[model samples]
Target: MDEVVNAIADPVRREILALLRERPRTVSDIASRFTISRPAISRHLRVLRESGLVHDELVGRQRLYTLDTAPLTGLAEWITFLRSPAGWQHRLDALETEVRRTSRERSTTPDSTAPKENTA
Candidate 1:
């Protein structure tokens, strides 16, 4: 999970993942899309592969890289959990409780600026 997060942290690697999501492509094919050198792209691919976010296969002397979404399932799950009603409700409830507690405390506390009653 850490590896996947680290790998996708880079802009180039995210773009590479997007490309692979569309379809598998050879190293040269991916390299041609960007101004960066093939070696740079290769290094990015290596990171993606090591992270288990992508897989490669050699065909006709060309290595084709493809997206492997299994590793991404954890990330997706985390995102879904964050977006769920329960998650927001928990946070909102905590906030509401704090607000109510503060309001109560303020009401109970006397205002020091209030005018005092004079006894003739």
Candidate 2:
């Protein structure tokens, strides 16, 4: 999971993953989307391949890279755990309290900034 996390930490690598998600692409196809050099894109692809986030298959003279999301299962679970209802419930309760407090203060505070009524 750490490798998967680290692999996707780079914005370029994430974009590569998005491209793979849409469809398999060759190194040239992936490299075309970024301003970075082909070697840099190759390095990113290496990291992704090592992390099992992508799979490459040689089709005749070209290699096509495809996304393999199985490795992200653990990361997904960790995220779901982090965003559990228990944690969000407390946060929502606190937000509700703060909102009510702010509303009460606004209602009670002086309306000095209020626009004066037009006297025809």
Candidate 3:
């Protein structure tokens, strides 16, 4: 569970994992998607690989990277544990996540029926 949490903590690493979901990609290919240099991307990938969320294979001169879902098994178990009636923390966290997402979506679009506040 610690590995899963750490692996997902960084937005860049998460994006890298998302890219690996579609298919294997070379290090350079993954680096091209972001503004960071290849070495920075390598560090992120290293964390992911150490966390068991990704695997790499040497294909000629380039390394091919792919997603490894095995670590997710532990995450699923953790989620199940967190969803139990005794786990109020998880419930609150889930609610907070939903609220944030809803607020973000609402902020992007105008609600025609809503009243405008005038502080004059």
Candidate 4:
């Protein structure tokens, strides 16, 4: 999970993933799309592969890279949990209960009013 997060942190790596989503490409093919050196692109691909976001296969002398997408399932699930209605409802209910308790306490307590000054 940490590896996935770290790999996706870079814009270049994200672009590489986007390209893989369309179709698999060799290291040379991916490198040609950007201004960076092939070595740099290779490094990015290495991170993506290590993170389980991508997989590669050797076709003859060339290695083609493709998106794996399985590691992303956990990230999707976490986002879904945060966006759930029940999660928000629980928080709102707790806030409402606290507000009601405070109001009740205020109403039950005797007022601490200052004495009024007598008029001349």
Q: Pick by lDDT: which candidate is best? A: 2
Q: Candidate 2, overall lDDT?
A: 0.96
For residues 8-109, could you state the per-residue lDDT of candidate 1 as single tens digits? 999999999999999999999999999999999999999999999999999999999999999989988999887876856889989999999999998999
Comparing candidate 2 with candidate 4, which one achieves the higher lDDT?
Answer: 2
Local distance difference test, each candidate: 0.94, 0.96, 0.92, 0.93
Clashing pairs in 1: none
Residues 18-109, candidate 2, lDDT per residue (tens digit)? 99999999999999999999999999999999999999999999999999999999999999988876867989989999999999999998
Better of 2 and 3 by TM-score: 2
Those runs of model 2 whose alpha carbons end farther than 4 Å from true positions after fitting are: 85-120
- Rank by lDDT (best first): 2, 1, 4, 3
Q: Provide the lDDT at 39 for model 1.
A: 99
Stretch of 10 with least lDDT, candidate 1: 81-90
Record all residue pairs in model 2 with backbone atoms less than 3 Å apart, i.e. clashing.
Answer: none
Show the colliding residue pairs in model 3: none
Clashes of 2: 0
lDDT of 3: 0.92
Local distance difference test, candidate 1: 0.94
